[model samples]
Target: MDMRETPGVTPPHPAPDVFGHVGYQLKRAHAALRAAMDQALRAHGLTVPQYSCLEVLAARPGMSNADLARATFVSRQSMNVVLRGLQDAGLLTRPATVETGRARPATLTGEGRRRLRAAQEAVYAIEARLVRAVHEDRLPALLADLDRMARALSD
Candidate 1:
């Protein structure tokens, strides 16, 4: 028998309105953040992905392309292209051949660090604006809630 027709069973509830749904709100915020980052990074001659890659590398140098791709939430193919562009721009370096494995770790050049520092100023300002929208005391709770939501979905 169909579950919906089973005795004592309840029908599924209708989905919430898009404007009222948490997932929808999260997506809207993500879209806005991406747009803001794109505009901010353009002045530094970087794309969102490129800036993400650089930011990751600065924190953890010598990361393989695959590692960087996963860290930046991009595809391996896309990361290869981003790395190549940065290498050509003299912002990063990757050895022509690896001694032990297929993954060639990438590191930022001096110029890359300088560019990242400049871009950080712009990106951090945008984040500051976002944080300022919420009450100071609520910020920690908000971050914790976001983390919990992510963990729940991931499981």
Candidate 2:
């Protein structure tokens, strides 16, 4: 049987162009958010990756460099540079030598925590601005949908 002949059915619309594509919109949104985050973090002497590493380390201390890279959505090499800068600034610490394997766990120092807290206030304000753009009743649902989308893509 032809599916087009089925009752009470309609065909989906084709994507109009780049402007109409959901992927394009998502990319645009990511770029905008990244820019906002970068600007906000800069005031605290932090880049986005640096802030991300500090944030994650605060939450889950002693994570390996590779794990931090994955959590921050950056290449391992890129994360190494971020880690080096943070380490140089005395914002974070790792063992001088790995005790066992090549993976040296990292942790935020007291200074790192202080900087992360300051950065969080700025970042949260930026996030609040975005949340306020959506209706109050729909905000939770919108956040959930975003989480779902991220999970889907990551998997």
Best by TM-score: 1
State the lDDT of candidate 1 residue by residue for 1-155, as single tens digits. Answer: 75335588443444444465678778999999999999999999999999999999999999999999999999999999999999999999999999897989899999999999999999999999899999999999999999999889889
Task: Score candidate 1 by lDDT.
Answer: 0.92
Q: Residue 12 lDDT in model 1?
A: 43
Q: All models: lDDT?
A: 0.92, 0.89
TM-scores vs. true structure, each candidate:
0.88, 0.86
Write candidate 2's Cα lDDT for 1-155 as tens digits: 76335477542445544576667878998899999999988889999999999999999999999999999999999999999999999999999898689998999999999989999999999988888889999998988998998889889
Minimum summed lDDT over a 10-residue window in model 1 is located at: 9-18
Q: Give the clashing residue pairs of candidate 1, or none.
A: none
lDDT of 1 at 82: 99
